[model samples]
Target: MSSVWAKKVNSSKSGFILSTRASLSRASIVGGALGFPRIRLPTKYLGMPLYKGPKKSFLWDDLTSRIAARMEGGEAKVLSPGGRITILKSILTSMPLYLLHVIVPPKSVMCRIERLFNKFLWSAKGQRRIHWECWEDLCYPVEEGVLGMRRLQDLVNAARMEGGGGS
Candidate 1:
């Protein structure tokens, strides 16, 4: 069965890796017979890391760096609250939505992102000012007398629910 599948797929051209527990090292035997190179565990597939076990903070380091890079700038300081909100909703939040839909990030990562948002919204430089309301209150619907900012966890929940996770 495996031989037949291997014969059907030209693995070298396809960039497919044969991942197995057995230590099959000889390329002449494994590659010729299986038509693929042996790969180590935790290979990346379609930009997301593919590995065994629960999601970890290291997996999200690149994404967090990207979010932090976007949040840092003189432009963020200059923008009004509404403009900052626009960037948060349209640019910053959307950056991680694709990953969030697939895996739930750790609490520390979420907190870091939230802190970046809060700082951009309230502070201009090293100086800090009192936030008029907590982040949760600010994330409420506009009709509730707050900015209609969607929380990252809430967005992940919604995505999970839509993907049939909710009963």
Candidate 2:
């Protein structure tokens, strides 16, 4: 395979090495003439992290931290409820939309995001307030006496369904 690829490249580069997560035997290593480099199990490719199996908490650590950092920027605290909602809809939710399109975030992660939005909506200091309505009711259309705030889980589920193509 390497020989075929080398033929295609036809380059005189001497430092060519094979980097893979596969386990190769000693004889195969000698036959391939490829140098193996130690690599971590999961690595980033094209900005998306690559792993061997299902998504896990560790895989989401960077994304979670990014969301936390954004929330901690103090922008949410200064805005009024309406302005906070606007920012939530336009900036905060959109931050993770691309990732949601690719992977269904865990419930805990979604809950943390929702908590941040909830705090911004109800209180200026990020504290919990007396609820006038349930989250489901709050997410309803404005005509229905609600704020029309789209739920993150619903969006994630919709994206998953869309990607699955009616299956």
Candidate 3:
């Protein structure tokens, strides 16, 4: 029967060809995607936190104990410049991005990750401010670089591969 033969053909295809292909193209399938969360601190600067204790300063110590607790716990999500751009792109692509931008600043685990990579992985100075760059910079190429941070688009693709797409 055609149905039986068709099922056999479908089963014979490699999972990556059958499954991975869709995931790779998920961003294209989904109209919008959720990005990493931004912080909720009431501040004007895009990356720095607001210091509201005695005088307005960016000093971490000036914040109240409650706020300090958040900081010590690394409450501020550190995004790499590349990740920041992805968040920005997400904002540009959909209503949620605008809403998230208006509601909060971007946050991530990237602050420390970027710092460590720049310092140890690149064997660079650990004392300087790290300029923001794209996430791809942190990733090893399919060939050369070490495996680190997930590529946003790749993640989007993976989601698609997993059949997580929507209209």
Residue-level lDDT of model 2, residues 1-167, one tens digit each, is 35544444323322222346444664366435644333354765444566666655576677767766776677666777778778777887788788788767667777777776665567666666775665555777889877888887778778867542111
Better of 1 and 3 by TM-score: 1
Over 86-165, each residue of candidate 1 has an lDDT whose tens digit, in order, gives 99878987888887788777877787787777776776554577877767677888998888877788888898785422
Question: C-alpha displacement of 77 in model 3, angstroms?
Answer: 13
Name every residue pair that clashes in candidate 1.
Answer: none
Model 1 lDDT at residue 123: 67
- Name the top TM-score candidate: 1
lDDT of each: 0.72, 0.65, 0.35
Clashes of 3: 13
Give the Å shift of residue 98 in candidate 1.
0.9
| lDDT per residue as tens, model 3, 1-167 | 35544433332321211223345356333413332222233443443454333433233222223322332333124545454335333432232222223332222322332343333222222234544544456554536643444433344445345443211
Ranking by TM-score: 1, 2, 3
* Every model's TM-score: 0.73, 0.65, 0.22
**Poorest lDDT segment (10 consecutive residues) of candidate 1:** 13-22
**How many Å off is the CA of 143 in candidate 3?**
4.5
TM-score of 3: 0.22
Instruction: State the local distance difference test value for candidate 3.
Output: 0.35
lDDT of 2: 0.65
